[model samples]
Each structure stands twice: as structure tokens, then as C-alpha cells.
Target: MATASMADKAKAKADTLIDEAEIASSASAGDVQAELENLRRDIAALTQTLASFGSGKIKEAGMRASEIGAEAADASVQYAENARSSFLSAEQDLEAHIRNKPLQAIAIAAGVGFLAALLSRR
Candidate 1:
């Protein structure tokens, strides 16, 4: 009779422990779900803010790039005009020099040809 009473007491203790464990698991699941919801809300808010800022930044950058492109085109036109002027001046000088020293120019040309031939052979 004493053994039977002890067995009943052990079974009651086991049932109580199982009930406490189930309650604790339920509470933990509720906490995890709440945390997930809060995190989702935070991510959505941040995504909206970043999208707004990115659009403004893209517009500003496009305007800046357009301005820079216009400036570069103007500079290129001016450089081409300067290069044309310099080339014409050099051509005129060379013409005058060749007219003044025809024989000397011929000798220089022959020397240059000889040097080119030697380099090509190597």
C-alpha cells in the first residue's frame, strides 16, 4: 500500500512539470512573433526613407552631369580652334624655311631616310 501511494505522487509531479513546460513554450513563441512584427515595421519605414532620398540624389546628379557635359563640349570646340591656328602657323614657317634653304632641306631629308632604313632593318 505504501508503494502504491509513492507511485501516485511521482505521477502527479511529472504531470505538473509537463504543464509548466508547455506554458513556457507558448510564452516564448508569442515573444518571438512580436519581435518579428516589430522588425518588419522598422524595415518598411527605413526602406521608404531611403527610396525618397535616393530619388532626390539621382535628380541632382543628373543635373550636375548635364552641366559638366555642356562645359566639356565648349572646351573641346575652343581647343580644336586653337590647334588649327597653331598648325597653320607651323606650316607657314616650314614653307618659308624650305624656300630659304632648299639644298640644306634636301640633305636633311636624305639623312632622315637613311636613318629610317637602318631602323627598319634592325
Candidate 2:
């Protein structure tokens, strides 16, 4: 009789363990499904928002690009004007130098030509 009681106790314990394992598996599956549903909801919301903003987003981007292009063009024009002014100033200085010292200018030119010939020989 004692042996039979022991066997019954062991069987009860095994049944309890199986029930606990099944409960745990079911709970985990339920949690996973809930998470997947939540993710789907979030993705759907984002898709809707993006669709609504499509045209407005593109127009905003285009306006920003145009502003940047205009700024760049203005900067280019200013740079060109500055370069022209600098070139004219340099020309004026050269003219003044030539007018003030014709002989010195001739001498400098001759020296430059001599140096050029010497370098070419090498």
C-alpha cells in the first residue's frame, strides 16, 4: 500500500509540472501576439502620416533648395565684382609703375627674359 501511495504522489507531481509548462507557453504566445499587433498599428499610423505629408514635404524641400540656389548666385556675383575690382586695381598700379619709371621697367623686363632663358637651358 505504501508503494502504491508513493507512485501516486510521483504521478501527481509530474502532472503538475506539465500543467505549469503548458500555462507558461500559452502566456508567452499571447504576449508575442500582442506585441505584433501593437507594431502593426504603429506602422499603419506612420504610413498614413507619411502619405498625408507627401506633397507638402516635397514643396517645402523645393522651396528650401531654391533659397539656397539664390543665395549661391548672389554670392557668386559679389565674388566676381570683387575679382574685377582687384584686377582693375592691379592694372592701374602697373600703369603707374610704367609711367613713373620707363627705364627701370625696361631693365626689369630684360632681367626677367634673361632668367627665363637660363632656366630653359637647364
Which candidate leads in TM-score?
2
lDDT of 1: 0.97
lDDT of 2 at 61: 96
In candidate 1, which residue pairs clash? none
Q: Taking the tens digit of each residue's C-alpha lDDT, what string does model 2 give over 1-122?
A: 99999999999999999999998877877798999999999999999999879978999999999999999999999999999999999999999999999999999999999999999999
What are the TM-scores, per candidate, against the unseen true structure?
A: 0.52, 0.58
Residue-by-residue lDDT tens digits, candidate 1, 10-107: 99999999999998877877798999999999999999999999999999999999999999999999999999999999999999999999999999
Clash count, one per candidate: 0, 0
Q: Which residue runs does candidate 2 get wrong by more than 4 Å?
A: 1-49
lDDT of 1 at 43: 100
- Residue 75 in candidate 2 has what lDDT? 100
Q: In angstroms, what RMSD does candidate 1 have relative to the true structure?
A: 9.7
